[model samples]
Target: MSINTNQFPADGNISGLPDVTELEKLANELFSLLPNEMPKANFSPDLADHPRLEKSLNLVHDRLPSLFSKGEGFNLNNPQTSLPDPHFPVNKTPQSGFGVSPPAVRPGNELSLNRPVSPNSITTNTDYPGLDHKQPSVAGSGISPSAAHQGNAVNLEDPQTSFPDPNVGSSVGLGHVPHSVAGSGISPSVIQNGPGYAEAFPFSPDTPFEPDFNKLWSSINTFKSTPQIPEIPGTGGAQYYFLQGAGFKGNDPFGINQNPTSQLSGKTFSHIQNGAGHAPFDVNLIKKDFPILQERVNGRPLIWLDNAATTQKPKSVIDRITYFYEHENSNIHRAAHELAARATDAYESARSKVQVFLNAGSVNEIIFVRGATEAINLVAKTWGEQNLNAGDEIIVSNLEHHANIVPWQQLAAKKGLKLRVIPVDDDGQILLDEYAKLLNPKTKLVSFTQVSNALGTVTPAKQIVEMAHQAGAKVLVDGAQSVSHLRSDVRALNCDWFVFSGHKVFGPTGIGVLYGKEDLLNETQPWQGGGNMIQDVTFEHTKFHDAPNRFEAGTGNIADAVGLGAAIDYVNKIGIDVIHQYEHYLLVYATNLMKDIPGLRLIGTAPDKASVLSFVFEGYKTEEVGAALNNEGIAVRSGHHCAQPILRRFGVETTVRPSLAFYNTCSDVDILVETLYRLRGAHR
Candidate 1:
């Protein structure tokens, strides 16, 4: 008789072979029991017919010869006689009239049904019975044989084999199967492996077979969600931790936590205070601090006129560096060792010293760099890169040293920025009107030197800084020359940034200070990446540290920094006002004496000048003048002074430069002037 595809009796009886879904569910349950590493069959169950099922079983037997023997065949046409009872124990012997042998089973071991069976052939649970007794019944629900077989098919060649689902009208692969069985609320693998299966399978009347997709997606979304990052407090703009207690509303004008006098750590400024109050500065007492003054050059007592090049270190500064290396020698921060703690305290203390010296509001505003060159380059690469766009203008002065000039030039060249220069008058002073003309909406940054290194011109620094601010431009004052001679009050100047080298201020070399406004430093990104500068680092991303730490990447010159602190202490003790007055008196005395010589021409004669004295003697090369001065125990620089543009502007390749300092006396100036006069006569 032809099979009826859709006829059912009132008792829920169906006549022919079970449909695809029931067979697939049974096959999935069976396959899930196997270990994941077991090789899976690749055959499709939809193609399984009585004839093909027999052929597939034969193929499994052929491939795994030791597992299945040839004699264990069964006939699907008479399953009632050949199959064992559905409810009775499977270990019981079969009754007579059976045409098939029982499925092979090893004692105390679960059955391995690695081959597929035709749906019609499996009429009862016991028909293929070596499944663990503890396992859940695949057919336990009121599902009749016909219902269990409906819509399900088993691929005999492979349990993982995929087949088209007639109910869904599409193919679903084994890998795509839902992790938990539909309606059962149990994992597919758990259902097939043993004990818990009986309770997990056979859906109750209240539970439907449909999967709850909404709940599944909700769990996935929770797993993939990102955590919210906490905002750092006190920064006026974006949320970031303020370094050195800056960026918060406070009564202190400079934003420092402690008073400037308190930060001095009990160091006395009495001498400086007395001198500023018109007490005469003891030149002998001041000269006692510089040990290098005692050295003889070419058998003559040394007269140092190279202060503009680099100042000699004071005894206090040298002692401070030696003490650091001897007692507090260790890398700063992130260590539990005693030396590290001391080193870190000393380094940060030095930073506070710089902050106080510059009259900067916070210690975070000060970044320790190698020298003035690196400080300018850092700002150029970090702030310049972020702010400068094509056609933007950067203003520099004709009085700028190469440290202040070259970095902007390179940045302007790379970023297509316009570099505008404020011209200087014949006296080497920056023309205020010309500088005002350079100020415009296009000016992003105005970088100029407070005191010209090549010449003695002292620009109107506070006025220039105010103009730049009015024009909506940030200003950087190169304080390399002026910081030693004049008091640097960054708050009063209102410049966005100021830079100076420690070596120029009677401190150690390889150390400098970059003082920026707290808000500006917070806005600028770090130009380098390495240890200490970063808070966290990964192959994919890096989070940087705040302000000073962000810019100071690796191990800094710790000993030198402490020495710079000592130098600041020295300057404060002696007083910058006293130094300025005494140096001015010496400059006038030297100028008058040198001008009396007929062949000498002073190169830079600005009235408001500091310590620099640039000149050219008639019929004598600049280098020859320097050598003659050296023979008389006077040391002067003879070069472009790294201000080539300014030197070339004056129509000269180089000049004989004798820059003075407070340590230089009237006697030193007299000897230098007399030596220049003798050299001029010899040339004539």
Candidate 2:
């Protein structure tokens, strides 16, 4: 079908459309009417002319010159006949709402509309499209109104004269206001309300604005001032002051303040006071202090060979307990009454005495408990529970008492940790090499007895402690036996913890002590809780006190602690070195005499041993030997002695144990050996 070139069907259906040739012809006719190049016009409105009408004329002339100058027949090629030159001034006339005219433009100088005007120049009226003199521009001109009225022509090319871009259309320029306005000698208020004003600027005729440059400059200068550095006064820094300062002289940072040398005054005891330095140890004189030693057992003089089980209380300890009950008996630290004061003084004085006795750095490191058993349990529950992880190992020597072994065994089982044992030699002494081999990174703790209760083997405690420390393990030395027979100096030993029972140390029963490093005690949590341990308490939360008080949760064994203090005083009066030397002599004497008995085997004959003589008789049971000794008024332990592992280590279920203290004599040792010989003869 043939399609028409210029007409479509009346129904508006496109069954017939114009051909491609016809479309090309129509495009050519539209292109021929457009100008070869659009002319560029600069319509700078005269500020003194009818400002509102002039602005409107300028907008129309710039955007649509054809409509605006249709009657004039505007031409692009002619300069004088074309749009007015931007450099030439229009005739100035007093027109309503036009306010004033800008300074006259220089002849033959032109501005290009395509190039941006410098922001510092007196802003032209055409800079804002809708603006008129009737409503002032919110972004004021950089030139003051007075300057403009006085005809001062701005140099657009000079950087100092260039204002911020007027196209920014704000009184406050985008980032920072240009400093040119400040140097222009024009008031800020004039710039805020003058011809350059626009709605985008913060200031207007209704709101006159000004800035406080003095305050701003002062703040900037202050910020740039140099800061002073502080100077320390000593060669070793702050630590030197802490150690040797006037306030810290003679004070130990770890907590102990007592001078060990000052503790050995001549006023400790009357008979021994003068002779304490060079006095010969008289077992007879020492026996006078213990009244129980004079008592008869089964019609014979009581020969206390069971010192390992518990020591007899001295007269001083008994008198101290009586004194507390009669004169100072009261619950301590909770009342303001006189008795409470006395009791509190007595209790704390005892703590101080213990601190001195152990040569601990601080009294705060001492914690009173039921005995060594509870002390070890406290560590297991508090420090052990917190520090042990699954698959970690805790090392214990074969010489540990049941008190030390059981608590850790339960802890290991609950924590899923391994309990490694350090085997002892045939002589019942812990093998130092074997102990060193057992220690590794996985070993968390090494808890050993200072002296074996069953075997009397005095282990190399200081060496063992040092080696464990080198392996990154904490050491807990059970001093239940050693504390009584030997002088204990925790500072010298350097073990993390040391525990001893007061009853075994010639003090009252139901009282003991746990000595720990100040830092370790502070780090360990309290195992028990009650009245005094808490600083503040609520149903939801509680704040506990520091160490010593934290671990001593409730009312302590008051009178017994005072008695233990008296016991320590008694030991100090006699001299620890003297007691240790005397006990060593007794041990040597007993060992030599016991070696001669036939049909008798002495177990635990370590080269370095305490005063214990553990033995077995052929053809006689351990109980029979113990019964024979008791019948003759001799007392000795006749079982595993709560140290089953060491007993079993020596291939025996039990042994007849006759142990000694400082008060035990050579006469007592002769009687014990003579009885053993009698039993051996009967067995034969």
TM-scores of all candidate predictions against the true structure: 0.60, 0.60
Off by over 4 Å in 2: 1-278
Q: What would the per-residue lDDT of candidate 1 be over residues 461-482, giving only the tens digit for each residue?
A: 9999889989999989999999
Report the number of backbone clashes for model 2: 19
lDDT of 2 by residue, 1-684 (tens): 111223323332223333333433443333233233311122123422543334433543453333223222111122112222232222222122221112211222112233233322344455333222221121211223333343342321121232332322212221222222322222222233232211122222242111222211121111111222111234221111222222323432211122222321111111111123333334554675689999999999999999999999887677667757866788988999767776787788788889999999999999999899999999999999999999899999988889989999999889899999999888776788888788899998999998889888888889998998998999999999998877899999999999999999889999999999999998888888998798999999988888789999889998899788878877776677667655754565566557667877888877667778899888899999999999999999999899988888888999999999888876677677778878877776
- Each model's lDDT comes to 0.64, 0.64
TM-score for candidate 2, residues paired by index: 0.60
Q: What is the lDDT of residue 249 in candidate 1?
A: 46
RMSD over all Cα atoms, model 2 = 43.6
